[model samples]
Target: MGTFEGLVAFSVTPTRPDESIDEDRLCAHIDTLIAAGVDGIAIFGSTGSIGSFSEAERRRVAEVTTKHVGRRVPVAIGTGAMTTAEAVRLSEHAEKVGADALLVVPITYWPLNEAELCAHYRAIASATQLPIFAYNSPVLTGVDMTPNIIVRLWQDGRVKYLKESARDLLRIPQVKEATEGRLRIFGGRDDSIVEALRLGADGWTSGAANIVPRACRRLFNFANDSQNEFAAHILQRRLAPLMSFLMDKGHVSVCHTALEILGRPIGTPRRPILPLAGEDRIHLEGILRSLEEEL
Candidate 1:
């Protein structure tokens, strides 16, 4: 298994109002992240709106992101599906397309027990040579992979990382202690990146990086340097507002709107998931524009 190290961005796909992936703009978004000096780029992640996309669309995203990233940085793809077989298929395609790793979320629809969840990851790990990071976003997935289960998977040597999105910041230490620091922990909570790192997380998978890559990297760097107070200030002044909109308003909408304000052409979010409207849009655009000015 490859070591999961460094600051990574779970990039949002730039799309049109109709929700089609804007290929050129998407490439530009990748360039934005690379230019910001991020360690890696994770496309089609939860913040990237991967669940709304089809397998073919996700594969295309991975291919494009990998091509643009080249060898400058590692590229991780989110290949989690509702079924083990589908996840394996997506992961195999990612490996074939030269992705560096796979961020696998648990199957969301039919919640599985710890044993079933373990088997799902084991199956995917067995299918591909790429490193696997188990994503535990219980808030979204409706299932939580406890520390014991996480330790078990890590001991198997197939699961290399954990995207801890449980909102329980304290769990970082627990997982680290349980695994003896062997399992790399990544912060999936945008509002608590530095807190997680302070608690022994190796790095972070930031959704805010989609619009504020440099700031995210700066926050991570500052925290790594033990400048907790300074980083927390920045998070409060800048990252926190954007994260609130994403968390309270809508993730994809805020991301798309932020991209627009930044002069990128990531289109509106897909259907069934509506675009930002009313005061939410005004507030999002205002915050983004203010942030752009500051940057």
Candidate 2:
């Protein structure tokens, strides 16, 4: 169940105008990723606006995605919440609803201590049999999961994988060496995928994949082979401009705009996070236009 590898595209939770999940559009959107040959599908990750939705909506998204996809590819659900109890409930729910794996982040309103962090994950480990990814996204979550913490979690057998998004490439090999290569790793940063692959990442949990899944997979395949590294790097350069944008701007807003550009509009970002507008929208349009041949 923990066998996540090679371009695990994060699905955008497309909502209707009323902000309920647009089930049909979400299905069609995921159909796009599957057709593009993405090795796995992840829902309700940061790209899915995990923090914005309620527990019920998150469950519905997980249930609907797993039910609709139905053994086509692995589906990983993000079970991160502000508290341990909420996270545990979501983890149990993900496993119950047939999620192939679980992605967990130490979400905290106040920054969590190392001990608090360990306890949070340990409780979740006790609650579910699903393989767990201890997600490390310092930018979004405001907490850095050091290699020491990940190593300790690995030692305790609490987390099965690390979805690393903290942009420091050295942490990949650091975690690998500390865990003796046991804790599987998925790279989450858009800009550093090539280096992450070279650093022995198992795969990438990508926001850009919501826009160009095929390119992400192609980059994964090509970069893995020394013979194809040159071609892969060349493609990565073409993709770099937009990749930079997705990171600089938020994933949800940029992806929503890019999808609309591709003539497949997924609704707006939930409020408190605004839609792409003015120069940002125009800039994104230019970026998409430049990549027509690649797309």
Candidate 3:
């Protein structure tokens, strides 16, 4: 169990027009991430549309990603499900298929108390020898894993990293202080990567990396190199608008649309959550155009 650090792409699931997973395109997407020089890949994550995939689909995606990535970069699979049993099953499958680490988001729907959340992660951590990064994304999961809970989990030496998506910048310091810097914190929100880095996050798990992996990589490098002005300029000009749409509309829709606009074969989001239409499309096109100019 070790840390898989640096700019990890929280991958977007590429699908066919009918919403089936597009395996070929997905592999190409992984290739793009690796080629763009990201340190690792986090597949089947929230940005990867894990919520919309069945357990079988999730495992298949992880397998394909691991196979494609091989030893080039570590591949972390999201093994978070609403039930402990399901999460355990997914975690075990990821271990079997050779995942380097697991990003465990809190179970959605039936909100668990802090004790329950700790137990849930402990169970999964015990189930596999693979490293686990507790993913805290309250906006989607509706459950916040407080720093105290994280500290308790870290004490067992099972939870190794944190993908902090809570968007509460204060929680970064709280987690750092609570854990005494034992747990490596990765910024999960794209727009706040620089802010998170300034506040002492170890790295980022970024959705924007889906389209502009090189740019995301550069931002991480710039921050680490202490080139704050250059990083900020890149974020404001190249990354901000797409991230804005992702925050305002929906992550999967915006990410998928951006990929399609960039000529990547990632199809639309699964239905009832359709692609951007009307004014949203115009706005996205403008954003993509602006982003293209920077590229």
Best by TM-score: 2
Q: Which candidate do you rate higher for lDDT, 2 or 3? A: 2
Worst 10 residues of 3 by lDDT: 227-236
Candidates in order have lDDT scores of 0.82, 0.89, 0.84
lDDT of 1 by residue, 98-179 (tens): 8888999885777799899988899999998988888998888899998889998999897888899997899999999988
Q: List the residue pairs that clash in candidate 3.
A: none
Tens digits of per-residue lDDT, candidate 3, 112-229, equal 9988888898899889999898888888889988778888888989888899888688889888988888799998888778889889899898888887787888888887776476
Stronger candidate by lDDT (1 vs 3): 3
- RMSDs, each prediction? 1.8, 1.0, 1.6
Cα lDDT tens digits, model 2, 192-251, are 899998988988889999998878888988988899989988999999999999999999
- If scored against the real structure, what TM-score would every candidate get? 0.94, 0.98, 0.95
Candidate 1 Cα outliers beyond 4 Å, as residue runs: 1-3, 231-235
Ranked by lDDT from best down, the candidates are 2, 3, 1
Quality of model 1 by C-alpha lDDT: 0.82
Tell me model 3's lDDT, rounded to 2 decimals.
Answer: 0.84
